[model samples]
Target: MATQPTMSEKRWLRALGATLWPSFLVAAGASIVFFANIDPETLRLDSLPGIEISRMSGYAIGFFMFWMVGLASSLLTLLLLNPTPERGPWH
Candidate 1:
């Protein structure tokens, strides 16, 4: 017979899977936006307007930021919803 996962394990697995894909999607989308907006030839420091700076950096930073946020949020949600596992030598 196949062994069933404990509830907490199942929950964490679900959360991890859910978090991973969405984070990847967000990162990919942001990278796309970054590549789309900024001209490689015109990557000068003084060329960017204030708003453009925010938008451009948002694309770059948001990619990683959102990914981390998604991962952390999912893990936190899992932790909040599931009971804590007991620590042991094997655990």
Candidate 2:
């Protein structure tokens, strides 16, 4: 047997899913499409010569960077969708 989640917990989980799931999917597709055209090794060598980063590591880093951007976009959209209360002293 398991206990049911409270309403707040459920809302939190829903918000988490809403934010992450779509972003993850978009990041996966973007990674494939972008990396297909651009070689990470060449990009890294051209951009950063001092650091030693492998091709696979570059892909991972790119994916995470895309994911972070997606997350920020998603969060901003969420914030905009939420209703703002009116500012007043009396209700």
Candidate 3:
């Protein structure tokens, strides 16, 4: 007989998968931005007009923001996905 995953195993795997997905998305986005010569510093996302930050800091902020956005979108999609119905013995 086949065995199902334990609750602890499922939770650990799920957490790893969740983290990896967002990390991969952010890494890919960073690579694309780098290749495209996009400057994160040029982005005017500051809440205060007089405030300034370094390019590295801008990139860091952008990375975290992208990861959060990707995570939320993925979670929403996952929650919306319906499971398949079970088959009957007669079918």
Best by lDDT: 2
- Model 1 residue 60 lDDT? 58
Q: Rate the local accuracy (lDDT) of all candidates.
A: 0.62, 0.83, 0.63
**Candidate 1 — which residues are off by over 4 angstroms?**
39-66, 69-91
Model 3 gets an lDDT of 0.63
* Model 2 C-alpha lDDT per residue in residues 17-90, reported as the tens digit of each score: 88898888889999999999999999988999899999989999999998988888887776666656562211
In candidate 3, how many clashes are counted?
0
- Which model is ahead, 1 or 2, in terms of lDDT? 2
lDDT of 1 by residue, 1-91 (tens): 9999997788657666776877777668766776578653355345544434554554556567767876677656656654656631112
Question: Tens digit of lDDT per residue, candidate 3, span 36-91?
Answer: 67666556454535668877786777777767777777666554543444531111
Model 2 C-alpha RMSD vs. true structure (Å) is: 4.6
Better of 1 and 3 by lDDT: 3
Clashes of 2: 0
TM-score preference between candidates 2 and 3, better one: 2
Prediction RMSDs, each to the true structure: 7.8, 4.6, 7.2
TM-score of 3: 0.56
lDDT of 2 at 71: 85
Candidate 1 vs candidate 3: the TM-score winner is 3
